[model samples]
Target chain A: MTDPRLLPRTIAVLGCGGLGVPAAWTLALDGRYPLVLIDDDCVELSNLHRQVLYATAEVGQPKAPALARALLEVAPQLQVEVRQGRLGPANAAALLQGCDAVLEGTDDAVSKFAVNDWAVGAPAGVQRVASIAAAIGRRGQWMVVRSAGPCYRCLFEEPPQPESLATCQIAGVLGPAVGQVGALAARSLLRVLAGEADSADGALVRLQARGLLRTPVAAAAACRCQARGDGAADSEPWGQHV
Target chain B: MFERDPKQLFDRYGRQLLVQGVQFEGQQVLHRLAVVVGCDGSPLAQAAGQVAARYLVGAGVGRAVVPQGGGTLLQQLDPLLQLAELPSEAQPPVVQLWFAARAYGASADVVWTDLSPQGPRQVRAGALQWWVGGPAPLTDAVALGAAVADLVVADALGVEPLPSLAVLDFSDPLAPRTRKHAAAAGPPLALPADPGSPLQELASKLSETLQIQQIVAAESARCYPAEACGLVVADADGQLVALAVANLQDHWHSQDPEAFSRSARTAFALDERAIAAQQRLGRRLVAIWHSHCDVGADFSAADVSGAYPNGEALYPGVAHWVVSVRRGCVAEQRVFGLEGGQLCYADVAVSGELAGRSGVEGRC
Candidate 1:
C-alpha cells in the first residue's frame, strides 16, 4: 500500500539513442512521468535493433521527436517533450536546470564527461541526476551515475581514449542489451522519484551480458556523484583542465 | 612405406641432392621432386619419405634421392649408389638416399633406418618402411644394419620407434578414408503447465489487492485531514500476496501551508522505509498508494512531474490509482497510466467484497 500519488515526477532522458530511447519509454510508460527526450542524431538503420522507439519508417527522422511520437502513441497521456540537440557544454547548464532528474545516455566520451561535470557543478539542492554508459557489442557494461551523490566526473578524471570508444556503427549492439539497461535506468529513476533518494543518488548500475534479458550489477561505492556534496576545491575536474 | 627424419636426411644428403640442374621434363626439378614426394607408394612408407624430404629441404639441403626398396638390405645399398653417382661440382657431393619399401609384402617389418655418421643408428621397423642414406656410404650401411637389429629388438619388446622418412603410395588417389562418430541424445526437461502465465496471475492479484488497499486508503482519507499511504507485496504476476499498513501514529501530516512542507518531507521518509521493506520481502514495489481527499481522485501536475531522488518519475507503470472518499461513501476511484505526461484512465476489475465496483472508469 505505498502511495500511488508519489509516482509521477519529472524525468529527463538525455541521449535518445539505443539506451536512452527505451529508458525514456519505460519511465514515461511505467513511472508515468513527463519526459524530456534529448538527442541530436537522426535515426539510422543500424540503430533499429537496440533503439526500439523508432521504426524502419522513422529512419532518417530526428531521434528525439521520433521517440516522443512513439512513446506518445504507446501511452498517449505522457508529457513527452523533445529536445532535438546534442548534450554538450553549450546547453548543459540551461538544459539541466530544475530537472527532477537528468539521465545522461550519450555514447560519446566527451559528452559523458561533460554531463558528469555539469551535474557536479550544478546546485547541491538539485536532487537526482543519472547517466548511463552502455558498452557496445556482444558484451557491455551499463554504468548509471546519480546526482545528489556523486557526479559522473567524480568517478573517472578524464574521458576515454578514441581507440577505446565503441560506437554502435562500428562494433554493433544487441537491442535487448540496451533495453535491459534502459529498463534498469527507468527503474532506478522511478525509485528515486518515489523518494528512495539515497539509493537513486550517485549510483552506478551495470548490465553486462549478450542478451537484454540479463540482470544488472549495481556498484555500491562506485558513484563519485555523491562525493560532490563535500564542495572541496581540491578535487580535479576531468583530471586535467580541458 | 618408411617415415624418414628430414634432419638426418639433410645431414646425410648435405649437398649432393640436385634441385636446379636436374629437370626430368619441362617442369622445374624441385617442382618435379615435390610431385614425386606427393606419390602414394604405400600409405606409411610414402608418409615417411615425405617427412624425410621435407626435413632435408627445410634444412637448406634442397634435394634428395628416393630409393624404392624393402628392409635393411635395400637401406645398405642406397647410400653406396648415391656416393658412386656423386655429381662433380664446386664441392664433394653429399647425397642422401630415401628408401621406399612397398614390395616388402605383409611380413615386411622394417621401414626406415637412420644411418647418419654423427648420431646413433636407428631403424623404424614393422609394417613400417625405412629411409637410410648419408654422405659416408660405408658408415651409413653399417649403421643401417645396426638400426634394423635395434628396431627388431624394440618391436619384440613392444617399444615404439619414431619414423625418419615419409613414403608416398601414388596408387589410387581418390579412395581416402574418412572417420565418423555417433551423436549422443540429450536428456528431456520438465516444465510446469501455465495457468495463464505467472506474471499475468500476479498482475491480476496485485490489481485486486491494490483495489482493496485503495478502498481502505479512501476510508482513511475521509476520517483524517492528511493524505493516507499503505504498502503491499505482489508476486511475479502482480498478485497482492502480502500487505502492510504504515503506522499513522508514527507518521506526520499537516493542514497548514507551513507545516505541510514539513509533513511532506516526513511522509517522503516513511515512503522510503515502506519501499525498502517491500524490497526486503523479495517483491517489486509494484504500486505506491496514497489518498487525495478534496484534491480530486486523479494525479496532480506535481505528482505527474515528480521524480524520484534517482530522477525517475513516480508513476511509471501501467496505472496510477487514486481513491477519493466523500462523507461516508467512496465517491470516486480512478486508475491511470501516463501518456505523454498526461493522465489516461485505466480499467480495473476487483473480486470478492468489491465485485460490484469493477469496470472501466475515467481518471477523476
Candidate 2:
C-alpha cells in the first residue's frame, strides 16, 4: 500500500467559501498537496472575514478563479486546478474523480447529504475514498465519513428545513471561530493523508472553546442510502445523472 | 450598501476594553497586554514586548526585540494608563482600552473582511451596524494589542500533556488546597475556574517561573547522587527569580556522619550565605526549592524535620518546592507549604493566557 503521508496527494475542495478558503490556504501553505477547487459563486464584500481567499478588490470576480488566484498569491509553488461550477448529483462523481480525498466545506445540507451518498455508494477504487466536512459559525459540525464507518445518512436521514440551518448570512459568525474550524479541518486532512488511522470510523467532531468533542456514529440498519448501487461502477456513459 | 468611517466606530464604542470568554488566565494575558500598551504619539501602533515577556515567558520569545515596524502609528492619550480596568459591563469586551489612537488610515480606506460565509459583505467595526451585527471588531490600538496578546496566549496554551509525567500530588486533588501567605489568600483559595479575581491573579504570578524549574532541574541532574538546592526570590508582586546555591550536604557529610549519611543523596540543605546575597539583590525569598534525584517529589520525614525543625513553621510564608529530576530531566514538581499548623500542598498555578480546551488544569 502506498503511504499517502510520504507521497503527495491531491485534495478536491468542493467549495470556496469561508470554510474552504482558509482550509485550502493553510493546506497549500503546507507546500505538499495539489488542490482541485470547485465553486461557481462570486466573491462579495460580506465573506471577507471567513472567505479570506478573495480580497476586497476582487469582490465581483467568480470565486473559483478568484480563489485560485488568491491562493497562488499566498502559495505560488502550489498546484491548483480550478473547476468553476457547482457540484450536483449529476456532476459530483466526475468533479470528484481522481483525487486521493475530498474536503466538503459547502454550507448546503442537500449537497452535503448527496456527497455523503456518493462517498458511501462509490464503486471499487473510489469506494474507500473519504470526505471530511466542516461547517462554521455560532453552531456547526465537522465529520469524517467513509464506508468503513457510517454514512451521513446514518446520522440524519434528510436535510433540515432551511430555517433550521443558519449560515453566517442569517446568524452572524465569529472571526476566531471560523479560524479555529478552518485550521482544524486543515489539520484533519493532513492527519488523514499521513495514514493516521481513525478507530471510530464515523465520528462527528464538534469544535469547542477548549478543544474538540468526538461522537461515534454507526451505520443505521434501516438507512436506504447505504443500500444504493455503487455509482462509480455504473456502465452508463458521461452526462448520465446518477 | 453605505460606507462608514472607521474612526466613528471607536467614538461610539470607546477603547477602554476587557477581554472575556476564554475563561481564567485569558484575562491575565489581557492584563499583561494592557501594561504594555504603546504610549502617545509613538510610531508603533502597540508594543507587545512587555505583554509577551510577562505572558509568553519562554518558548524562545525574546526581549529588546526589533519592532514589527509595519504601518502602525500610536495614539496619544491625556494621562497614559499603565493599567486600565474597565468595570464589568453587560457585553464582555473583546479588549477594552480607552480609545486612544490617531489612525493613519481611515475606516473607509482600510478594507474590513466580513466574517460571514454568505459572501464578502461589508464589515463596519463600531456602532454603525453593531445593533444587529456580531461583536464589534477589535479596531482600537489597545484592543489589537490585546488581540496580539491573545494570539500568543492561544499558541502558548496549546501544550499537550506529556505521558511521561505521573505528577506527585503536592496538593490534594480531592480536597481543594489553599495556602495563606499574602493578604489576598483569605479563606480557602480555590484555584479559579474563571478570570477577573484578584486572589487568583496573585496566585498565578506566584507559581514558579518555568525557567527556574528548568535551571534547577538541569543543575540537580549534573550533580547526580547528590541533592541540589536553591533559594528563589520573587518581587513584591510574586514574580520569581531563582538563584542556585550550593547544597552543603557533602560538607556536613564529611564531618557529621549522620548528617551526611542518606541525606546527601536524598535531601538538600541550603547554604545560609546565599540569603545575604539574595537580600542584597532586593528579592524576598518566595520558595526554597530542591531536587529529588531518584524518587518522586514527596517530602520525606528527614525533609520535614530539616525544613521545619522541632515542628515549628520556620519559614512562615515561604513555599518548599520539590523538583523530581529523573534521568537528567525534570519529571514533575510538587510544592508544600506551612500554614495554620498543617503542612499542606500549596495550591499554586501558573496561569497563562489561553485556557486549554481539554480542561487539563495547569501548575503555571
Candidate 3:
C-alpha cells in the first residue's frame, strides 16, 4: 500500500490528451501530491469523449489550463501545475526536475524519443530515477531507468521512419482503449513511485484487453544514454542486465 | 445468496475471487467502481466492451462508460458519456481507456481492453515485450477483458490483479487462470549503445556507405539460431567487402554442455581464419561483426571480455558491430569499440545502404 502522504509523489504529465487526462485525473482524484500538466493544444469537439478532464463547454480552451481547472474542481486540495507549452530540449529538464515520474502520452515518434533522451540524459551523477509509462494504440508499456536496468533508448534508440508511423487519424483507436492504456500506465507508474522492489526492475509490461506480458530489458553495453558505464564490467551480454 | 441477484450472476466468479483471497468491503467495493473503456467496431473491442460493462454494471458499479472511438458516434449510446477521439495537432492510433476514474479521487481507475491491431501485433519497447498474438477463442479480447474487469473490480474493492497478468480466458474450462511462463533461464543479453568514441568518425563513414550494416544484417539472417561471425573490410577500390566466419560455438558447446547449454545461441567466437581472410583480401579488418540471433545488437560481457581478453584490444584501430536478428530478420544493427578503457557504441546510419539496397545485391 502506498501511503501518498508519506511518499509525496509528484508527477509531470507530458501531454493532456487521452492518456494524460486519465493519468492526471486519477492522480489528482487520489489526492496524491501536486500534478503538473504540460501541453499546448486546446480542447475541441473531437476530443470530448476520450480526454475525460474537459467538458463540452470547455471546447476551444487550452488543454493544460482546462485540465488543471477541471482537476482542481474535483481535487481542490491538490495542486495542479499547468505549463501551456510543448516539451522541447530547453524546457524538458527544467519542467521535469524534482518530479518523481514522467507519463509519456505524446502522439509522435519525435517527441517520445526526445523525452526519453532527455530523461535518461539528466545531468550525470544526478541519479535519474524517473520511470516512464506509455499507452500507444491498445497497449500499455512501461520501464524504470536505473543503474541496474535499461532506459527507453535501450529498446528504441531511433524513431520510426515518418511514413512508417501510425496516428489515430490513420489507424483509429477505441476511446476507452486509450483510457485503459492510460489506467494501466498510471498503475505501472504508481508501482514505480511506490518503490515496489518486489516488481521486476527495468522489466517492461505490456497490457492489452486479454492479458499482460512482461519482458526484461537491459541497457546496451555501448549505449551513450548516460545510463551506463558506472560499474564492474560484466563479461557476458544476452541474459544478464549489463 | 439471492437467487435472482446480479451477485448470483457472478456467484462462481465471485467464489473464485474469494478463493483467491481478494479483500473488499463485501459487495460495496464492486458497486463503487466507475469504469470507462474505449470501444470500437472491432469484434474484439466490441465483445470486450460488452463483457467488461456487464461485469461492472452487474456488480453494481457506479457506471461503466464505453466511448466509441474513431469519428463515428454510437447511435443509442448516451451522448453525454460517449467518449470522443481526442483531436490534436499530431494524430496516432492512441486510445485512452481510463476505466473507473469518473468518481475522481474518491476511486481508483482501472482499465481492461484488448490489444490494438494498429501497430505490430507484437512490439519490443525497451525492456518491455508486448506481443498481441494469442490463440483464438480462449484469449479473444472479450473474454480477456472480462477477466481484467474481474481483476480490476476485485482490486479497486482492494485485491491484487492475480496471475501476474490478470487474464481471463473464459473459453478455457478454467474460466479464469493466470498466465505462467518459465523464466528464460540463462544470462541476460548484453548490448552497449551510443557512447562517444574516436572510431565514431570511421563508424559514420562505414554506416553512411552501408557497407557494415548491410553485411551484418545479411549474415545474421543467413545464419539463423547459431551466432554468425564475419569481418568487414574495404577492397583496393574502396568497395566494402564482408567475409563470413564460422561461429565455432557448436564445438565449444559440446566441450561444456552444462557450462554452455546455450552457447550456440548465447555466445560467439571469431575464427582464427580471419587473419588469413584479411590477408587474402589485401584489406585490414576494419570491423569485427557478429549476429545476436537470440539477443539484441549490443556488446555482451563476453563480447567486451573477448575484445579485451587480456585487458587490451586484440585488433587495435578496428571496431566491432553486432546485428540483432529476430525471427530470421535483422531487427537492429549497432557498432561499438573500446576507447580509453571504456566500451562505447557509434552511430550506424541504418537508413543508408543497409536499409535500401537488397542484401544479396550488396554481397561482397
Leading candidate by DockQ: 2
Specify the CAPRI tier of model 3.
incorrect
The regions of model 1 sitting more than 4 angstroms off are A1-9, A197-203, A210-242, B1-187, B191-364
List model 1 lDDT by residue over A65-106, tens digit each. Answer: 888876676568888777777767677667755465666677
**C-alpha local distance difference test of each model:** 0.42, 0.47, 0.51
Ranking by lDDT: 3, 2, 1
Model 2 ranges off by over 4 Å: A1-9, A127-131, A197-201, A209-211, A219-224, A227-242, B1-364
Give the CAPRI rating of model 2: incorrect
Predicted structure with the largest TM-score when compared to the true one: 2
Candidate 3: residue B217 lDDT (0-100): 71
My TM-score estimates for the predictions, one after another, are: 0.37, 0.48, 0.41
lDDT of 1 by residue, B155-264 (tens): 22222222221121111111111111111111111111123443234335544665564455444443444445554456567556334345342344434545445453
Candidate 3 TM-score, true structure as reference: 0.41
Residue-level lDDT tens digits of model 2 in B1-364 = 1022445322211111111222334323322332222222332233222222222221111111122432111111101113222222112212221111221110100111222345543321110000001111122211123223323333222311111111111122122111111212211211112343332333355443556655565576666557788877876676678777888887787778774685568667789788877778778877787888745454556667777778776776776777655444444355666545545453233223211111112321
> How much lDDT does candidate 3 score?
0.51
A1-242 per-residue lDDT for model 3 (tens digits):
55544353467887888667666655664565677788989876555434644655677889899888877765689887877777765677676766655777767566666666664554433333434555534445555554335666677767789789666544433334455556445544554456544132456666554455667665455455643434313222112222
Shift in Å, residue B177, candidate 3:
8.6
Write down the worst ten-residue block by lDDT for model 2 chain B. Answer: B126-135
Tens digits of per-residue lDDT for model 2, A1-242:
33433443577888887567656765665657789988888875555434534445666788888878866865699899988777767787788777656677787777787677666676653433345555543234566655434667777878799788755554444333454355446545554455544322356766543334567676545455643445434332111223
